[model samples]
Target chain A: GSSRPMKQTKESPNVGDVMSRDVVTVFEDIPVEKAAKLIISGSFDHLPVVSRDGRLIGIITAWDISKAVASGKPSRIAEIMTRRVHSVRLDEPIELAARTLDTHSISALPVVDREHKVIGMITSNHLSRLLARRR
Target chain B: GSSRPMKQTKESPNVGDVMSRDVVTVFEDIPVEKAAKLIISGSFDHLPVVSRDGRLIGIITAWDISKAVASGKPSRIAEIMTRRVHSVRLDEPIELAARTLDTHSISALPVVDREHKVIGMITSNHLSRLLARRR
Candidate 1:
């Protein structure tokens, strides 16, 4: 009895639609102190760690930098970066991104392309903005 | 005419309804190094800095810790804490909280009482979770 089309009702936005395109990444070989400076200088909390080929190899967060400072850990990003990085594809559903973040207890995820290169970044901040607009 | 009452249609949640009540606060005089440790040990990024009488004075965030480490700043919390803090009331609507966050470009807000004491905390994470549930 509804007038809305099925396509209109089922059009869920993909991660690419909401993810931030201006992603700032750090090289894995960079010093932790430098990484700390980069994170502190920016408004964001997470930075994707990249390889020489510009592929996302890991992630370093403000929490990781705090841990480094708190414990006086090693100097290089390789020593403190989370190597087991979780990411999503550009075409993935937003719900899947939300579930992935909830399951891993992370605030952000790197959106990779077919070549496994970082194309964008998505975070709970983006989701919050989406929700705010919905209202 | 619809049978639904106006109250039923207009019932909106407040900041107190969704904020995290188990807030962890730090005294203003505590060493910044200790606050860094506290933030590293917990899953939170922001800590409400309070006075001796437990009134919310300012906030120290992981970003602040990173800045301290990067710039080799002073040791005390009061020297580096964000003194001009923005807060929300318990009974305020969630839209107001969202607007405040958007306007200030801050991720979290401390939910305060009539005495200006922090009773709970709300962040973008809470808003993201609310959105996830709505889906």
Candidate 2:
């Protein structure tokens, strides 16, 4: 049950159409230091956290990596990742995805399929670019 | 001149009063890889770029670090850091600081004084927390 008002659109675009397909991801058990390196070197603020079987398990952000590093204690990505992640389905409307970003105060969401495998990602940057182009 | 509207307030709190005193920062001369490590480990999305004297010169973001890493080329924080940084004065109202963050599409701003040295930092997280507490 979504709390925000839905933006009505005829033949609304699905997330699969709007999401960035070249998704960047991180492993669950990697050292926090290495994960931080991947995230930093990759220039991504957030990365989809994946299990060994390539299933979406959690989500991690630069903020999460920083906390782990700041702690000065060894840690793993899984420990720092946000386990209760908000994700959008491939078939979901674009407006719903946008609403999800706003409601959660997050920049991006990993798009998943029925098997919960990440297929792509949608982010505020993409949404803003889309809006800008329309104007 | 700021492109965004300047938020007005009476008896406004200066940034120095509200900003985080323990700001996480990076040196301009540091390797991009190291900067990424600092950003990720610190759980901070942005870090003020400082000169050897600890004077603010530029700023870097997690996105910048990730890009540098993804580029797979040798780079320094100075090369990737945004030299044209948006900073707030220590005496400026907190609303102005908030507006700056909103207009810039950035998560945080480094607070500077007359010497352009970073004295503190303000971020969206702090603003949200402040609002949450007031409610």
Candidate 3:
């Protein structure tokens, strides 16, 4: 038998089940100033960058923009995107996803298909709702 | 006329600037069993309770846990927490404090601080890396 009671399973939920389906993204050629405007206007914390083919090549966030502004670097998106991204599969359990959030200390995870195409975005808020509901 | 350069201004930010300060509150008494555990987990969404504090009497988050779980809810943190919280002056400015999370929907903001309290948190993560070396 398993360690925990089979019926009383799960404490937190999964990224796929909780992440936000509405994600805002940008292209590679966009200027940093323009990207910053999009982040502020769209009221988004992060922006995913996609190639003309719709492949998620990198991710950008408002924080990155702040850093760019403070660093006085190139005012372009491509100049500061995180090519390395931590992502999750849609079907994974919430418990597993929570671990990813904690272990990585990240606020959001981009959910993707097996082909690595972006489907949705999961965040801490999504997880909190699931917890509140079961209560 | 108002303050720093109309454009070259703002440093820290606002509550609307960066606040995961995700309000993940619970009911008056939900046994605290499932609730506490739920917070430990959950991938997203801050299960907003109705009647039920739905009127917005209170808002809770995962951090409340280490507190509640440690204090023992039902046995809950409501029993020991300050009840009095420190919220932000939203619609302020990013240069306000590096101010909120400085992460995901602008690191996430509730956009309403006039309810008295419980708008959003805006953790430190939302603010860091935004300060990453621009080089």
Task: Specify the highest-DockQ model's number.
Answer: 1
TM-score, chain A, candidate 1: 0.90
Q: Candidate 1 residues B1-135, lDDT tens each?
A: 233233312444788888999999999888887888998777888999988878899999988887887787677989989989999999987777877776776778999888889999988777666645543
Which candidate, 1 or 2, has the higher DockQ? 1
Segments in model 2 whose C-alpha atoms lie over 4 Å from true places = A1-12, B1-44, B47-56, B63-81, B84-135
Two-chain DockQ for model 3: 0.03
Rank by lDDT, highest first: 1, 2, 3
Per-model TM-score, in order, reads 0.89, 0.55, 0.48
Candidate 1 chain A lDDT trough over 10 residues, lowest sum = A1-10
lDDT of each: 0.82, 0.69, 0.51
Candidate 1 docking classification? acceptable
DockQ versus reference, model 1? 0.40
Docking class of 2: incorrect
Chain B TM-score, candidates in order: 0.89, 0.84, 0.50
- Provide the lDDT at B96 for model 1: 79
User: How displaced is residue A14 in candidate 3, in Å?
Assistant: 4.1
lDDT of 2: 0.69
- Give the winner by TM-score: 2 or 3: 2
Better of 1 and 2 by TM-score: 1
Better of 2 and 3 by DockQ: 2
Q: What is the per-residue lDDT of model 1 for residues A69-133, given as tens digits with 9 covering 90 to 100?
A: 78876879899999999999999988788778767777889999999999999887787666455
